[model samples]
Target: MRAYLATSIGVACTAVLVLPLSLPAGALAASPAAPPSGRDAGVRTGPGAHSAAAAVPGSTESVPLRPLGSTRAPGGIAEQGVAAREVRPFSLVGVVWDDADDELRGTVQVRTRAVGSHVWSDWLEVETHNQEHGADPGTQERDSGTVRGSTAPLWVGDSDGVELRVRAAEEEDETGPVRPLLPRGLRLELVDPGEEPEALPYPPSQNSPETRPGAESGTATGAESGTATGTPVSLGTGVSPASGTMTGELAGPAAMSAEDRASSAANEGLTELGAAEIPALTKAAVAAQQPDVAAKAYAAPRPRIITRKGWGANESLREKRFGYTSTVKAAFVHHSATGNNYTCKQSPSVLRGIYRYHVKSSGWRDIGYNFAVDKCGNIYEGRAGGVAKPVLGAHTLGFNTNTTGIAVLGSYGGTNPPAAATTAVAKLTAWKLGLHGRNPRAKVTLTSGGSGKYGKGARVSLNTISGHRDGFRTDCPGSRLYGKLGTVRTSAARYQGR
Candidate 1:
């Protein structure tokens, strides 16, 4: 993908950032400072020595799958996977291959041993047809030459031992049963989200601003005072040229990378540099920014959203620059399919794991979705440009150009989605869609960029708010959750004053 340099803020495009690649213990700082009691407590603090695992940067272990031999299956199973064995601690797993264009026409199942325990769990299925969510087939991001085919990541909590299998589907032929060919380069990926980073302080202060082309007159952008008046400002120690605030790690050139500055600058209008979360805005506050839309009574109150920083994202893990599309025409909803075994308290860890999987394991530039919601109704920023901007996402394959993706954490194929989760989806869509003057209840036609269900340039009409299955032939946003789209649309429209 084309990387947008932070030249606007004086960040040199050629700056090199050297980072460590060691897989430290407690690599994913995943656990909360104080985990909740009961079942969740056990998940974070498993019985035995693992309870005190040190927090450190996360790591990935990719093991090749091998044939299990004739003794394993009745039909001489046409399968490939690793036998049960102990290894480093990891909380998520998936299968990936070298070719992004090749599809895995088979089933993937994995079983695991809980960290520090000998008990082995039953085999759990992984989503094999997850290629429906990716960059458009021929975009620079899709053709970045590093993309790969991967299954939906499965969260298995803390585990040190794993057994996995990938079985090809058998079909009846004239001679007998025949098995289809499996994709090449099949490997099981074990992911450790690593230790969660320390939470940044709330109400983050803007960092010290650097010299800009037009700022020699002491005048600053409206990011600080909400209006770009020619106000004279003093530039000194701990003083921001835009807003005289304390200079922190995020603003100091020595402390921040060029990528970090660009990311923070993208959200300058909505938050201060290095802010953890974007504060919720009342309808009046939102209306004040758009008087015309307010006069038309067609705006939704901005929802509170947790920034990537709030979720402890290691920005260094992703590509150094950002990508963007022209506008957000629709919102495609999805279910993480990572299972519902986690508590709201562990949501950040979940996000971090997924982020790491999408980048390091799946061979993507960043997390596929634009936003993520927890079962408890918390909203988080997904891809790193700007929440309000049309940040090009690796979601909805052919439809990634002008649409945003919102994934509610957890699988919903059999289980019903929580009311809070659906409600948060509605609230988020209402505000984000309103920004582009889209009516969640309206229908819009989008041209396909080449997906399994549609060819490039094929025009299809769909809801402004639709499920992941709407654009592809996969069971995403599951049946139970997909059924809730109607309610989400109605609620979002109402919130937008439609």
Candidate 2:
């Protein structure tokens, strides 16, 4: 049965009073003596030796404790218990003892080998008796006690010895009386091996198959020995067939199946483009167009992109750097709070300020958006370009992960966005939609519940563009600017068709 050393009140007392027990002859020396108050007893090791040095403070040595089988006391009461049957001679396992309360309780097991001999099959029994007078006139009152059953054998002795065999009472059984079985004061003996060899459980088997040797054995067969026949095979298990086995030859690209050839062609196409492809395309397109008079578009200097400093650089922005492939299910717009009272030329400074606040002070690595538009209608880049390539940005909670981030430069909450800025944003949107092969004027549905501010109504696809507050909890783009999302989309469509 599973048994562990229990530290109950009885166990505590047992640990306390068991001190001062005498050591067996040749047992290791007693530990440093304990004070009269029984405090500061250090750890003890030797058999039947009480060592204050070995005892922990406030702890006492426990008497040998054991569990007996379930049985009823002579009376009708059901009692379950165990007895310490025998202590082996010269055995390292120790004797039993009781505390000041006269309670017989505590675990007794083999101590470490350094201090005592390991003895197997050892035990100590305990019982209590009534004091009575016998016929002998000169004799004082005598004490006679009844016998309790033996404890299960605990293994002890050399490395091969049986360890302590402990058992516990079943749940249905009651613990027997401590009084009669264990007297207030009684010395327990330590037992050891005699002469007859201990009874072993089962003789070890010598015919196990694993111990055999040869090519046919369970062990691995090497290539030189050539025990295996057939082609070398690489099963996922790492087993390879013997050498001189035939494996199919590799197929050349020309010999590939139709599907494989098609896949290879696609991969080659992707590799043909270099890192500068997107930027070059953007520059060429802008150069071919006339600056919109309404937006007053002009070329802006490209800012030097900074990588996150220090160890933070290692974090990947692959998703942000490469645009992700997503259905342009909807579009969201917002105004940079810092640009509330600023003009288009001040956009760079605003961006720098945002970077300082988010990256330097707030510990973010980069500005978190896909693109930013200025009052002059110039579209400035934000976040790693790759994120815009195929992945959405984290601009708005919940919706940002799926929607593209487009920030306008000024506060539009109450006042309308600059006509130039609005017109520029429209032209930019048309260009982007064309690149994705979508018609800017396509009829689409806009759901208000996603952002929660708009009332329910069916709007055209051009009306799908929404302000940031439409999908997130924010006063983005100002109250005046946010309401014009539909108009911006319609204007962008008209410009693209023109």
Candidate 3:
């Protein structure tokens, strides 16, 4: 008999009411008390107490930025940010403004104090070109009244104190220097990925999926740690020798709401309903599953990937229905731009933080990328749709319709992405692109969905494996990581026997 982790049950039980995305100015007068501020602003520190609102899977605190007066320098610049103050414990931070069409043409920087420390870290800059990575124009996800402009999130680990500043970029003219106007409704977002979900009991069965509750929040080991063989062996379990087909008593549709059932049904054949992850398969096993003989020859082994449940994703946060594209034609690589100061142990927490920020603060339908890879080479499913399907993502602004987005978790502007990370990318694209018969080394034509770099409906030719910059005029995936695309393409092609 085997007991599976009731991750699906966790989703069914943790139902949170969706809140209104934005409020008019008059509503502020009737709102709840403002968040604490100033020197005496010590906030309670705990796992579930971090959210600015009531307990949700994770939490986001959106605080308004106040003006800091003129610099009185040669540039005639103005600044805005919060003074150093204590707040609820948070690990990731980003800035957001009211308008989705607005661009934050300025420099944004932040400094933080570790949860238990008095010292503060040096100011770090947050990338401001995040508009290039989002839902395409005219789509429901993009035109939803809730969408807003945002800066790339920065992971600062667990910090209890924070201070930040946003300065308008300066321009030189005949009369000294002039600064541009900052977008209105500027607010700082502090995100806290909530504690890992607890494992609940399931009826015993020989085929029950394994559970790793403790491993979800910290460094993974054994099966959850991922082995080179790509097969995970289940370890601990409490069981009784009982056997039969899966029943409603074992947590079936009877225990889940209509919405939860819809979400689980999307991944029907990928894993057991409510399973924490989709287990890995050997290359031969993967090829055997493909019906086409030619496709079988090119199919690469499916890599081990953690599911949304495995990472404690609060399923209730996203819109009920999962969205899909016609087919996956290209793969666009990106860097999370969430900084690089995290350990493999903290990857799930970081994911949860980004998830909350994407939906709660930036006002998107869900986490933008289709999948994510960690610095340690671990792969995790992104978005709520099936891993093997062509799930439409709000990643590359104009090319999201027919392409999949894979974001490596960390900044790579100057720092090089580890060899392990790039290898994982190659392995992922080999299996994913091979499914659609795409050749990694070949060029493909993708019509633009309207981006700063390309007009809507423009036929644009791009590599099958492309950097985020290929479709948009932005420094995404970063220079260091972007420079490795040629190597990634060649390696991915080799994996597919090209």
lDDT of each: 0.68, 0.32, 0.69
Against the hidden true structure, what lDDT does model 1 obtain? 0.68
What is the per-residue lDDT of model 2 for residues 99-189, given as tens digits with 9 covering 90 to 100?
3123222333332231233332222211111110011111110011111112111212222121232222223236744212332223222
Worst 10 residues of 3 by lDDT: 1-10
Per-residue C-alpha lDDT of model 1 across residues 207-281, encoded as one tens digit per residue: 112221122312324333222222222211111222111112233244766435644435656766466766555
On lDDT, the stronger of 1 and 2 is 1
Instruction: Predict model 3's lDDT versus the native.
Output: 0.69
After superposing candidate 2 on the true structure, give the runs of residues whose Cα lies further than 4 Å from its correct spot. Answer: 1-327, 362-365, 439-463
Model 2 lDDT at residue 93: 25
Question: Per-candidate TM vs. native?
Answer: 0.77, 0.34, 0.78
Number of the predicted model whose TM-score against the real structure is largest:
3
Candidates ranked, most accurate by lDDT first = 3, 1, 2
Residue 352 in model 3: lDDT: 86
